[model samples]
Target: MPPLPSHEYHVGIICALHIEMAAMRAMLDEEHGTFSKKAIHDHNTYFGGQIHNHNVVIACLPAGIDGVVAAGTVAKDMSRTFEQLRFGLLVGTGAGIPNLEAGVDVRLGDVVVSRPSGVYGGVVQYYRGKSKAGGMWEPKGMLNAPPVVLLTALQSLQAEYELEDSRMPSYLAKMLERRPKMRSMGYARPEMDKDVLYLAAYHHVVGRTTCDACEVAQTLARPPRVSTDPQIHYGVIASGDRVVNDAVTRDRLRQDYGALCVEMEAAGLMNDFPCLVIRGICGYADSHKNENWRRYGAATAAAYAKELLLHASIEETSQEKPVQQILGKSSETTRSEQDWAEQFFSKKQVTFQ
Candidate 1:
C-alpha cells in the first residue's frame, strides 16, 4: 500500500455493526481509495484505508462503550503518526426517535452528530472521587468538546429535514411514565433483534461493570462543543444499558427529553473519547423498525459527512496557496482601439457591438 496522505487530518469512521460499515464501504469510490482490513488483538476486525484523499480508518468495534473506547484508543493512537488530527467521526444507522411517521418517501436516513464534549464513566468517577476527598468537584462545571459538536450536528440535520417535532410511540410513553426515575435519568430502553450485531456489540463492549444507566454515565462525562456554524446543534442524546423495544418507553423518553434521536453507542463511546456521535435515523424506537429505512438513513448521513470532510480539505488546500497567485494576471493590455472605447465607457455612454 502506498504511504498515507501527508494531510493534517486523519478521519476516523466507525460503525458499530458490520452491515452498516459494509454499506458505507460500498458507497466509497476510488476518490476515497481502497480499504485494507487487519486483525487486531486477535479478537475483532479493524478496517483501515483511505477515502476522499483523506486517511480514513473504519472500525466496527464489538458494540458498547468499552468496544467504542477500545476502537477510539486505536484510532487516536493511529492518528499520532499524522502531523495533525483534524477530527474523529462516528457514523452508522440508529433507532429513530419514537412517534414519528414512516412512509415510502420519508427517507428515514437522518444524520446525528455528537458534540465533542463526551462524558466517560472513568471521568465521572474521577470527579466523584475528588468530591468525596473534599476537593472542589462540581458536576455542573464539567465540559467537553465532542458532545457539543454532536448536538449541533444533530440539530442541523434535523432542521434540514424538518424532523424537529418527531416523538416516541404510545407504548414507549407508558414505559417512561412507569420508570419515572429512568426517564429523569435519560435512560430509554433500546430495541435489539438477535440479528442486530450493533446492539449486541454495545452490550459486549461496555461489559457488565461500566454499563450503568445512561443518565449516570453521561452526567459524569462532558458534552461536545457547540459550533457557531448554523449547520451543527447541541442537545441531550438518550443512552441506556438495555435496548428500547417498547413503544411506550420510546415515546415517553422522546416526549420528556425532546431528544433529537436515540442510539446505543454514543453514551458508551462518549464515555471515553470526547468525540462526535452521528446517527442516521432508521426507524422508530419500537417494534416497527424498518431495515430498509435504517440502511438508507445511514447512507445519507455518511454521504453528508463525506461532503463535510471534502469541503474542509479543499478549503485547507486553498489556504496554503499564495494569495497573489490566486488573483491571476492583471498586467495585460487591450488593443489600441479599446483605449478609445475605454475612455468613452468611463462616462457610461458606450454600448458593446
Candidate 2:
C-alpha cells in the first residue's frame, strides 16, 4: 500500500534501560521485523528502517529522570520529521507492586501508557495548587495525557499465557525476611535482602519526581493549561536510586505510599513527566531479583503495550463514528477521548511445544 501513510506508521518507541530496549527489539523482530541499530546517544539507541513502513526508534537510556527527559525530547524531535506521527510509546520492564497477586503479573508485561500531566523536574513544569505535600497530583488545563491503550494489550497477553509463577532473586528474597516490620506492612517475605526494598522505593519515587520537575511555582505562572483528550490511568510508582534487594524497604513503600510498582526509571521519569505509573511485578522486593522472571515480566508488559498501539492505530485510522462525532466540533482539539475496555482478552493462538 502506498508506503502506509507517513503519519499512520511513524511511532516513537523508547526503553528506559538497555535490557528493556533489547527486549523491545526482540518483540519487534517477532511482530514487525528486524531493526538495525544505528547511532547511540547519552540515553537512547537509534534503530532505523524497520518493518511495516514504520521506522522503529529505540532508546535504552540511563535509569532516572534525566534519562527519561533526554530520551523524550529526542523522541519528540524525531517525531517532527514524520509526515504521520501517530503517538509515542514507552515500552520495557519494571518492578511489580506487592500484594497485587500472581494473576496480575500478566499485566506486568503489558505496556503501561502514561498520560502525562505535564513536564516537571527537568523538562516540563507541573501545575500549582494541584498536588499535596506527600503525594503527586494531576495538572489542570487542556490535558493531552499520553495514551494507555498499550497496557490493555499486555493484559490480554497475560490472560493468554495464564502464567502464574512469580519470582525474584534468592539473595533479594532473603533481605526482605530480615525486616519483620516491613513484612507486616505487606512487603512480601524476603528470600533475599532488606535494604533492596528501601533503596528501590526511594530511588523510584525520587527519580520520577525529579524528572518531571513539577515546579508548581513555575507552572502557576503560566497561562491556562492546554489539555488534550487521551486515555490514562493514575497511580503511584515506587522508586529508589539504588537497586532494591531488601524486603523492609519494599514493605515500607507499599505501606506508606500504596505504590503499584517499583522501578529505577519511573521516579526519574515521573519527576519530569506528569504520567500514570504502571509496573509489572518482576520479583518481590528481595535479593532474589530473578533475571529470567524479570525479562519475561518486562516482555509481557511490553507486549501488552504493542497490542494497545495496534488497537489505537486502528481506531485512529478507522475514525470510529462516535469518536469523529465527539471531536468533529473542534479541529483545534489536540486529542480525541474514547473509552477503551479496561480488561483486554488475548486473541493469539497458543501451541504446546
Candidate 3:
C-alpha cells in the first residue's frame, strides 16, 4: 500500500527532546516514513507511522530550541502540514515533584499524565495570564484539555489499571526487543539503588556532573517497593518556561498549583493545540537532578502513551473534529492566519472535550 498522505494522519505526537522522539518512534507498530509536506514553511521533520489502529506522526522541536515559544512554533507548523490532527501527545522527560505524604510520590523513571484533578484541567501554565502583572493571571494552558476521544480513552485506561497494572512494561520490553541498542543508552530501568531521593535542602556539590560526588547521607530515606516497575500517576502538570532545579520552587509550584510534574513545553502546545502531556520522571525537582534516568524516563512515558492510544477507538478518532477547524480555520488556511492570536482566542470552547 502507498504511504499515508499527511491529511490521513489522525494523531500527532510532539517531543521537545531527541530521546523523547526516539522512544516514541520505537513504539510505532509500523514506520510509514515522512509524507510530502504541503507547506514549505512547515519546517518540522516528520516521522510518520501507525500505533495500533491510529496513524501517528511524531516530530521533535528543532535542535537547541526549546521552551514555550519554540514548542508553539513547532506545533503550529506541524498542524498546517498534517491538517487532520485530532489531538497531540507531548511525550518527554520532566522534573517530578515528589510528595510522599500526598500519595503522589513520583519517583525516577515513572510516568505522570495530565488529568483533571481540580479546576486546572490536567495541565496549567502557572505564569500565563492576560494581565501584565504575571502573577495575577495564570497562563492559559489551563484553558485547554485533551479532546473527548482521548479523555474517554484515558478514563477507560484508568479503569483498566484498577484491575491490573499498566501495560508499559510489556510494551517497553517489546520496544527494546525490536531496538536492542536502546538498552546501552539507558533505556532499560536503572538499578533500584540509583533511584534515590535527596533532601530538599541538600544541593549537589557544585561543578560535579553526576551524583557520585554528592553525599548520600543528605538524601531522604524511604522503604523500597518489591517491584521496580515504573508507576503511572495522573493529576495536574505545571507547565512553564523555567526548569525547576531547586526544592523550594518545586515545593512552591506543587503547593500553589497542585501539580504533580513540571516541564518546559506543555504551555506552548496547550494554548494553541489541544494535547495531552505525558512525562517520565527523570529526576526529582531538586538540586541533585541529573540525566541518569532520562533515557528510561522517556521510554516509560512513551510506553504509556502507546498504551493510551490502544484504548482510543479508530472510529471515534476518525469522527473527531480536525485541528484546523478547532483553530477557526481549515486545512487550506493561510500561514499568516494560522499563527494569529485572534484565531486561537476566537474559539471559546477550544478544548473540545
TM-score of each model, paired residue for residue? 0.49, 0.46, 0.88
With a 3 Å backbone cut-off (N, CA, C), the pairs that clash in candidate 3 are: 128-138, 128-139
List model 1 lDDT by residue over 1-353, tens digit each: 54345343355566776656754554443324333332333344445455566656555666553332355444433333332444456677655552323211111444445442235221111111112133222232222335333344444555644644222122234434554553443223223221121221122222332223222222112222242111222344554333554444544444444454556555434433444666666665544335545544555455556544443453443333222222222212124323432432333222221
**lDDT for model 3:** 0.80
Q: What is the lDDT of residue 49 in candidate 1?
A: 55
lDDT of each: 0.42, 0.37, 0.80
Can you tell me which runs of candidate 3 are displaced by over 4 Å?
129-141, 328-353
- Maximum-TM-score candidate: 3
Distance from true location, Cα of 190 in model 2, Å: 19
Deviation of model 2 at 97, angstroms: 2.3
The residue-by-residue lDDT of candidate 2 on 1-353, one tens digit each, is 11223343445565665555554554452233323332233223355334333444445564554333354454433444332444445555555444433222212222233333224211111111143355533333232333344334434444544563222222223324443443343333223221122223222223442213333332111122132111122244544334444554555444544544555444333322222333434555543334444554444444444434443444543332221122212212122110110110011111110
Residue 221 displacement in candidate 3 (angstroms) = 1.3
